[model samples]
Target: MSNIESLLPHLGEDDRANFMKAVGSIGAAFAARTTIEADPQVIAALPQVRDHVLSGGGVELDMSAALDALKEEPSISNQLIAAEVKVAEVSKIQSDTANMSRIEKMNYARERGLDRPRDDVASTMTMNEHAAVLAGLSPVQRMNYARRHGLV
Candidate 1:
């Protein structure tokens, strides 16, 4: 028998069942809160723990220790933080681009070398013309434009 299974003999049948159910519930709750990928061993163990609890035969397991064990496992928390940072960066870029005037956007794009000629007439281009040039650039190009102009 496993070390955990050997502990079951200390509890009465009803208490064992309840303990197993509690462990399963705790595992489910932990899975919901974090992005940790599921493991087959963990999947199988939760139900067994519940079964052992239901069997009403095991010693009282330390609930805090069980929870701590889950907490100690490496999770996707870092990946989540990185993803959030990327989203915030994209959001900031979009906000900066939206705030720029058409002329400023065009000049910013030109500074990024987006193939538009740096003609003397560029400074005199109409708002519509500026918008047209800005529209021709990709979203990434627009972000670069904003970054070059210190708008980001």
Candidate 2:
């Protein structure tokens, strides 16, 4: 079982269900708040519980202290937000590239110097031809293309 699964048995039924729902919304970085040493399952689950509290996961517990605790760690929250932004940017780039037309793909390759002898013919190239051209680019060239399109 995952660490989170193992820790679930320690919570009350309602608390456990709420915690599971809250975990889906919590950022991955919350796990960093935990210590390396083994502890009681309930103690091990505190970071997630704290996240649930901060998120107002329909629990009756007062959140003032949890809010205050989060206020004290602004940097961690900022880092999490920044990481989320990067993930979003990458996802957008992937979706955009995956749906790009042949002309669009060739234009991207040409802009990154991955295409040779750029000409009007590129604009009329078939999808198979575009794929072959893009596939033939060097690793560095491919990386450059991705970076230019904000995939990296």
Candidate 3:
């Protein structure tokens, strides 16, 4: 069994599902946000520094001022920052997924003769069908129909 699957036995069902969702969300976010950079330690790492800037989110900082901050705190770790950013992104994704999953589960339960709402509009009519209905009417009738529906 996978690590997450093994952990499921230890958790309540709701918590297990939540944790799985959180993990999946985090993995997805990390995958999305990752960017590769050249390793600094390797020789022939041209230009002597990784002065690469992130592409436009419209950050407005003077390079000199930014450099001074870096000089003061040279131990800054992108991995930590990225991890925190990813956690927030992942949480949002998990919440959205959970909500959608709940809806889908409810829909499935309904399909299985469970708590389904009545009065569902099951019409599969296309736009062409709707247009045909309009076309079938006399011009005056169509105009009146459109006027009544505020479509005119």
Candidate 4:
């Protein structure tokens, strides 16, 4: 299957694109020059970045060049710096998109009458109704409810 084909089921177009971009960035970084011993932190972050890039099809870069860039930062190693920058950006993008996708999936489930509460045999509410119920609660209350229900 194509990279986005499988991911498409899990993400919307925008999110999928961002995710792919993040993944591509990592791939480029991986392909770029790198020195394993230059910075341990950078070394550690490289794999994570690369994983995102390869999965997302974002960019193709010379891994050796990336490594060299990291090595340039002698203080903490450019690897770590690059890794941090890449990961932070990608992670934020991933999380936001994932949350949106989750909302969509949840809404879809509700639309299909698939999110019926186990305890309420007659409470087959629509997505809107479920959303209403959630909207009525405060953020703290929601957190408490989720915690109580083991959803957190």
Candidate 5:
């Protein structure tokens, strides 16, 4: 409400259609960013996207400036501002996890067969860290690993 009031002065009186397009653009941009960032594999590749959005510029979903470029009525402008807030809220929801205790989190994971044993050393590796560990092993060590894991 207040955001719309603040930005209304920048819009032209006849820009209702452009305001709608800007709002839609802002929403589509946000949804696209969210989709890209959701994938752990792609996340590492998009440093520009990660640095810009994940680090800071995400909430800068700039519909304010978008609307400011267009001309719109006060009523439509208000609705557009409200839509921008809705876009920002999706990112907020992603950052927040349900307030669960560690035990509860473990239980939740266990229920879904996703919990790792607390003492499992390999569970903590990043990406191909295990491959590096395996590469470092001696022939004797490799044979032992295969025997211990019942792979031989």
Candidate 6:
């Protein structure tokens, strides 16, 4: 606040009020975005969400808190932009292409394996299949099963 205040007189012909308003708005949005991202579940869900962000589609999120934030510190743009970035994270049906550069979009496309089927069950035995089959076992039970199958 002091920094902005010091600059206000030097802004000269610039609208000081508008400058303050813009600064406050940016602050609010960053705060709100930080709040939403603190949850481990949200972080865990991101890979899927990035798909939506990559595609230029909207994700429905509750923005009432963000709206109320403008009354205090930051602007709505950061909140919205942050949300769009989040949106691209989870939904396989979408991606946040609007916010991405062409190079980034192309990189995403390349890394996403456009040719691979989304559901690819292996025709051969895989470690992932072992994990799924073993998921319900207690440690002792898993050991017993492994020994029984000559897999220990």
Candidate 4, residue 45: how far the Cα is off, in Å: 15
Which lDDT tens digits does candidate 3 get at residues 49-125?
11111212123323344333333332334544665787897676566457567778567545654442223533455
Residue pairs clashing in model 5 are 12-71, 15-71
Candidate 4: clashing residue pairs, number: 21
TM-score, each model?
0.31, 0.28, 0.20, 0.21, 0.21, 0.20
Model 3 is weakest, by summed lDDT over 10 consecutive residues, at: 43-52
- Is 1 or 6 the stronger prediction by lDDT? 1
> Which parts of model 2 have CA positions greater than 4 angstroms off?
1-29, 32-72, 101-103, 109-152
lDDT of 1 by residue, 7-31 (tens): 5577667665675566566666556
Candidate 2 has a TM-score of 0.28
* lDDT tens per residue, model 6, 2-93: 33344446654434544433334434454565553232222212322222222222443223443343323334346556677766665642
Q: Per-model C-alpha lDDT, please?
A: 0.57, 0.52, 0.43, 0.53, 0.45, 0.46
Show the lowest summed lDDT stretch of 10 residues, model 2: 34-43
TM-score of model 6 (CA atoms): 0.20
Which is the leading candidate under lDDT?
1
User: 97 in model 6: Cα distance from truth in Å?
Assistant: 40
Query: Could you give the candidate ranking by TM-score, starting with the highest?
Result: 1, 2, 5, 4, 3, 6
| lDDT by residue for model 4 (1-152), tens | 24333444576666556555544554445445342344333443444334444445445434555555555556546556767787797676566457567778667556754554345344555656656766889999877655444344
Relative to the unseen true structure, what is the C-alpha lDDT of residue 107 in candidate 1, on a scale of 0 to 100? Answer: 77
Ranked by TM-score, the better of candidates 2 and 6 is 2
For model 2, what is the error of residue 64's alpha carbon versus the real structure, in angstroms, after optimal superposition? 13
